[model samples]
Target: MATPKHDLPDDDIEYVSKTEMKREMTALQQLGEKLIPLDKKQLATLKLPERLFDAILAAKKITANGATARQKQFIGKLMRDVDPEPINELLNKLAGLSDRHSAWLHRLERLREGMLADPKIVENFVNEHPSVEIQQLRQLVRNALKERELQKPAKAFRELFKLIKQYIPEPALPGLEASGPEEEDEE
Candidate 1:
């Protein structure tokens, strides 16, 4: 086999092997697949390009296996131009699979348990987060305990966790800008 002639020197020529290119495209396709099931609220949070977002939405509507696979590959081609770090971070967060998010959830679980075990345990949260409503927190703890005793569905139990999550927000993941509900444009 003869090598193709080129003006650039061998060292100046940058070539990506077919194997590596295929690997990258496969990874992008997997990422795009992950985006397909996300609800509108979750998808709106990402800074995805319009074309890629539309492709994801379209992929959601495709029911045939072959068509879905081809659409996913098309999405991979579009992802080549987009940065993926933020998307991965947000997806991890939504899934609650990130280390920091797991720890945050565990902490909230512990807090919920403490509140259920002792109503006075809420003072800990009050001291730590002044925004917590004392009455609401107490009511939820009471309702959760009642649910536990009565062996009913954990409606209030889950609500108790939501309340804690609301008052004590998750810390921002490293390398991502943290935006609070009240964030304003800086001068």
Candidate 2:
């Protein structure tokens, strides 16, 4: 038998299970699937290689089930040569601020503005969200008004927004359970 050619000992070679490799391949395929739905402009942002970009475009066009599966597998194989971290990071950044999330933030801003504009809005806020500490809310509002009058830093104003966030739950994604910090828990 031929002696081992390399310097490293045979015993030092780390082994990976077949199952782990398959799991990684599946994840890559799923990531590729996400890229497929994006328009050409969005795909351009990823700067994929010509072969991989063409493969993705072809995958988008295929309707036959078996052919689509094979194309997806090919894309997964191509993805193996690419660094997925940057792709995943970019995809996550793109996914983060959905329209719903933006609208929710705007609503919170409007609520804060309304409270500042009208004392009655504070009462309405308290009534709408009974879980909040009424005394703390009022104090924060008063302090925020005083800060505005004195031209001081808007510490209480920002704090009031934080308090409101703690009380109001973020809008849930469709078909998914709402996952945020417990509303009753004081931070």
For model 2, give the 10-residue run with minimal summed lDDT. 178-187
Best of the candidates, TM-score: 1
lDDT of each: 0.80, 0.78
TM-score of 2: 0.49
Q: Write the per-residue lDDT of candidate 1 for residues 1-187, one digit (tens) a residue.
A: 9988989778987899999999988998888788899876566667678998899999999999999989989999998997788779877876657787778778889988998887567887888888778888889888989999999998889888888877877787655556443221111
> How close to the true structure is residue 76 of candidate 2, measured as C-alpha lDDT?
91
Candidate 2 structure quality by residue, lDDT tens digits, 61-109: 9999999999999999899887786566556535764566556667877
Off by over 4 Å in 2: 1-6, 10-12, 97-187
Backbone clash pairs for candidate 2 read none
Whose lDDT is greatest here? 1
